[model samples]
Target: MLRYVINRIIVALPVLFGVLVVTFFLIRLIPGDP
Candidate 1:
């Protein structure tokens, strides 16, 4: 159970980072919105 939780967290971290990066760029590209 502990190992599973750890693995999930590790996987989630990258996905979260990717989402943040995409959102950041998307916000910039749209312009006139923030």
Candidate 2:
């Protein structure tokens, strides 16, 4: 159980990082009018 959770976190970290980076770049590219 604990090992499974740890492995899941390890696998998810890179994916989460990628998403965050992409979103950051997208926000930067978009206009600032909301």
Candidate 3:
């Protein structure tokens, strides 16, 4: 059970990180705020 949860988390982490990276780039491209 714990291992399953950990595995799921490991898979999710990259997806979440990717979303964050994409959002960051989109904000930077659109806002160009400093």
Candidate 4:
């Protein structure tokens, strides 16, 4: 259903943001510049 899809997308947004933030920091923490 359209509502279900929208709800899923809303829920996934925060998780995606978290992943991006964590990945960014992890890459930044690498020994050599990435």
Q: Top model by TM-score, which number?
A: 1
**In candidate 4, which residue pairs clash?**
none
lDDT by residue (1-34, candidate 3, tens digit) is 9999999999999999999999999988895647
**In model 2, where is the ten-residue run with the lowest total lDDT?**
25-34
lDDT of 1: 0.94
Q: Write the per-residue lDDT of candidate 1 for residues 6-30, one digit (tens) a residue.
A: 9999999999999999999988888
Better structure of 1 and 2 per lDDT: 2
The sequence of per-residue lDDT tens digits that candidate 2 reaches over residues 1-34 is: 9999999999999999999999999999998888
How do these models rank on TM-score, best leading?
A: 1, 4, 2, 3
lDDT of each: 0.94, 0.98, 0.95, 0.94
lDDT of 2 at 30: 92
The TM-score that candidate 2 achieves is 0.82
Candidate 1 wrongly placed segments (more than 4 Å): none
Q: Per-prediction RMSD in angstroms?
A: 1.3, 1.0, 2.0, 1.4
lDDT of 2: 0.98
Sequence-dependent TM-score of model 1: 0.87
Q: In candidate 4, what residue range of length 10 has the lowest lDDT sum?
A: 25-34
Candidate 4 residue spans exceeding 4 A from truth: none
Q: Which candidate wins on lDDT?
A: 2
